[model samples]
Each structure stands twice: as C-alpha cells, then as structure tokens.
Target: MTVNRRFTLAARPQGLPKDSDFLLTQDIVPPLQEGEFLIRNHYASIDPAIRGWLEPGGNYMPPVPIGDAVRASTIGVVELSRHPDFTAGQWVMGLNKVEDYSIGRGDGFTQPIDVDAVPSPTAYLSVAGAVGLTAWFGVEDVMQPAAGQTVLVSGAAGAVGSLVGQLAKRRGARVVGIAGGAEKCARLIDRYGFDQAIDYRGKDVEALSADIAAACPDGVHFVYENVGGACLDAALLNLAQGALVVICGLISEYNSAPQGARNIWQLLVKTATMRGYLISQYLDRFPEGVTAMAKLAGEGAIVYDEHVEDGIDNALPAMLRLFDGSNQGKMILKLI
Candidate 1:
C-alpha cells in the first residue's frame, strides 16, 4: 500500500502563524478508481494569500475548515494513473493543497509540461503557474498604465510585485517600487529597472508619501498595491485624479486581528477605483497571462526570484516568515 504525508490546519491563529498551528501526519492511500491518478508532489507554494484563508470568517476564498490539509498550489509528477489523460512520469501543477500525493480526476489540472521547455519543475509553480500569471494579469487588467504615467508597486521586491512594475515599465509607466530595505530597494531599481525604489522600513507615512510625490511629479497614475497598512495609506495620499489602484494584496494586514481597510475615503476624493481581486476570477485568462509572462521572462524584460526551503518540515516555519517580511521572494518548499 502507498502512503501520503500532509499538513493539516491544527489551530486558527490570532496574529502571525506559528508551527503549532500545523499538524503533519501520514495516511495510507486507497486504490485509485476509474478517471483517477496519483501524483508525487515535487514542490509546494507558500503565499501571503494563505494567511487570509486561515481566518474563521467570510473571505472570498473559502476557509480551510479546521482539520483539513491547508489549501495551496503544488507541482508534482504522476506516479500512478488509472486515467488515460494523466500518464506516469508526466509533470503537473494545480491546486493540490500541501499533500505529498494527491488522488484526483484529470479535469482539475492543466496538461503536464515538457521538462525540456522549462529548466526546473518548480518554474511551473513560479512563472507559468499561479505566481507569475497573477503579476502579469494585474498589470494588464488592473493597472493599464499609459506612457509617462507613474505606477507605484508596494512589496516591489517580491516575485509578483517585481514583475508588475517591470511590465508597467514596458507599457511606458514611470515605475516606483516600495520595498522593505535598502538591499531590496537596490534590487528593485538596479536589477529590475524600476524607475525609483523607496525603502519603507522605518519611514514615516507622510514622509514616504512626499517622496513618492516627488518621484512622480504628475502624481501617481496607478498604485499597484501589494503591501497594505501605512504604506498603502502613503500611496493613497498621492494619487492622481484618475489613477487606477490595483488591490493585488495586503500582506501587512494579514496578521492584524479583525483585518480592516484604512484610508478608504481617498478613493472617493481621487475618484479612483479601489478593487479587490482574487485569481479564481481570472482563471479563464490564465493561458494568456502565462504566455505573456513567459515571453517577458524569456526576453529578460521581467525578473523572477524564489526563496526555496528544503523539506516539508520547514514549510510551516518558512510560511510564518512571510508576515514578518522575512521572505526575499516567492516562498517554496522543495520536497524530494
């Protein structure tokens, strides 16, 4: 008999997540029925959005429901198949949660990738998969920045934030990035061609707002927000009359008790559209986003980064760091 290891949501957290919140265990796998296949997971994604899902209330993504293996994106290879669509040895990625193996019908996943096209199997979860696609679509669908307009991206040093800024630059937007430190800020501009980078660590919101205003003399035309809190407010204070505010994420607010939106009145004053988006709504456009992002990545127009930790034992601790600004880029667990 085959066995599977999984991470279950053991406890709901108050602020930031802790290792105790997760419970890891193994179970015997049952025989596959018709139209079913078994996958050996290669990697699992750790994202800020996962923090929002752990809440015990109404979030756009359904709550994990205590005692269930947490929901996540995983990349793996087919090990056993009773279905014709999924063949053994083929690599695949989709919503596989955090299990070492999954038994599911073929309809839930994309066709497996050619190992020759992408050098790493993990690239599927990073670039062509959910992370990169989210960044690509956020730039096109939400920002739509025009030539000479300024697009401000918070969490600008991160995987999604970095891509969003560069893509905006391709469209001729003056790109200003807000990252946590001097090192991250340098990487944003020096490495990724961001027009200007602001280090938000220990900076006052009013001062930060002034700097952003100075960097963008015409006021910001688009705020591709990823970090919420005072950084979000700073961006809010300097918006142009008709700017689009892409509410891609709110990493700062994830650990706060009873998460709330602040400085919302700025929306009405600037006549700005402040919209919250979830990737599930954009599933229909996944391929288009994937193609464009892959093209940019391949052409050197977009930069990609991943902070990989080895083994499932580190998954809980590694994910806890995201809320603390400890992660350098997209966080992934490399499972053997």
Candidate 2:
C-alpha cells in the first residue's frame, strides 16, 4: 500500500487563517477500479479564493467540509490508471486536495498539459494557469481598451495583475500599476514594464487618489481591479469618460468586511461601466485565452514569477502568504 498524506480543515477560521486551522494526516491509497486513475501530485496552487471556501456560508462554491482536505489546483503525473482517456505517464492539471496522491476524475479545471507549447509544467499553475486566464478574459474581453488608452491595475505586482498590465502594454495601451511598498512599485515599472507605479502601502484614500491622478494625468480608460476597498475608490475617482472597470477579485476584503467604495458616483458622472466576472463563467473560451497566453510567452512578451514552498507540511503557512502580501507572485506548494 502507498501512503497518501493530506491536510484537512482542523477548525473554521475566526478571521485571518492560522496554522492551527489545518491538520496534516495520512491515509493509504486504494487500488484503482475500472475507469479510475491515480495521481501523484507534484505542485499545488495556493490562491486567495480558497479562503472563501473555508468559510461556513455559501459562496461561489460550497464551503469545504469541516474535516475534508482543503481544496487546491494541482498538477501531477498519472502514476497508475485503468481509464481509457489517460495513461500512466501523462501530466495533468486539476482541482485536487493538497495531498501526495489523489484518485478519481478531477472534473473542474482539469486538462492534459502540452509540454511542447508550454516548456515548463509549473507554468500551468502560474502564468498559463487560472491566473493568466483571469487576466486574459478580464482584459481582452471585458475591459477591451483601445490603443493609446491608459489601463490602471490595482495589486499590480501580483499574479493576475502583473499579467493584466503586461497584456495591456502589448495591446498598445499605456499601463500603470498600483502596488504596495517601494519594492513592489519598482518591480511593476522595471520588470512588468508598466509606464508608472503608485505606491499605496500606507496612504489614505485621499492621498492614494491624488497619486493615481498624478500618474494618470489624462485619466484612466480601463481599471483592472484585483484589490477592492480604498484602492477601488481611488481608481474610480480617476476614471476617464466611459471607462471600463473589470473586477477580477477583492483580495483586500476577503478576510474581513470591505470598506465601501465612496467614489462610485464618479462612475455615474463619467458614464462608465463597472462589472465583476468569474473565470468559470468563460469556461467555453478557455482555449482562446490559453492559446494567446502561450503565444505571448513563447515570444518573450509575457513574464511571470512563482513563489513556491517545499512541501505539503508548509501548505497553511504558504497559503497565509497570499493575505499578508509576502508572496512575491503566484503562491504554490511543491509536494513532490
């Protein structure tokens, strides 16, 4: 018998999640039955959205059961299979628990990796994964800014925000990023090629808005919002005529009640549009998004980073990094 290690929810989180919220345990993997396959997980994605799943109430998906393995997007090799659709050696990406092994068809977000198209398997969990798809649909489909327009992204140094900014640049739009700290601001301008960067680390809404106004002198035509709260208000106050605001996520409020956006009146006055989207809603167009991202990556037009931890034992701490803003880019747990 093979040992299958996993992390289960120990207690519901009170506020921000703590290490004590999860319990690491082991079980034996049973032999695969007809049409079944076994996966040896190599890497797992730790996303901010997973926090909502840990809560008691209904969300975009049902809350994870009290003692079940915490959910994650994992990439692994098929170690054994009795299924006609898969072989023992293929690499696949799917929604799985943070564990050493998994069984059953990983239904959602599951697909075989094309190694020739994407040279790195880990890219499936980072730039070419859900992160890139979120940025793609949010920018190319929803926001749809024209050339010479200005796109401002909140949480610009992060996984989705960084890709949004870079993709906007490639589309001939001037890009500006709002990030916390001098270091992240510099990375936005230097690494991601944003035209300007505004540091929102410790500023009040008024000050942040002023900074945004100065950076976007002509006003912003597109707002890619990964962060809500004060940043959303500031971006709203700087909207150009008929601006489009794509709400990708609200990382700033996931752990607590959100501070209301006070400047939404600007949207009314400017005749602007503000809408939210979930990537799952565009499942039919995933192939288009992934293809575009891969092409851009091959041409060296897109750059990405992954902040990976070493083992499943560190899953809780690694996940906590998303909220704390310590994770540099995409947060991942490497289980192999």
TM per candidate: 0.95, 0.96
lDDT for residue 122 in candidate 1, whole number 0-100: 72
Give stretches of model 1 more than 4 Å off: 108-111, 258-261
Q: Candidate 2 lDDT, tens digit per residue, 257-299?
A: 7676788899899999999899899888877887888778767
Error of 2 at 220 (Å): 1.4
Tell me the deviation in Å of residue 190 in model 1.
1.2
Highest lDDT model number: 2
Worst 10 residues of 1 by lDDT: 108-117
In model 2, which runs have C-alpha deviations exceeding 4 angstroms? Answer: none
Structure candidate 2, residue pairs in collision: none
- Taken over the whole model, the C-alpha lDDT of each candidate is 0.81, 0.88
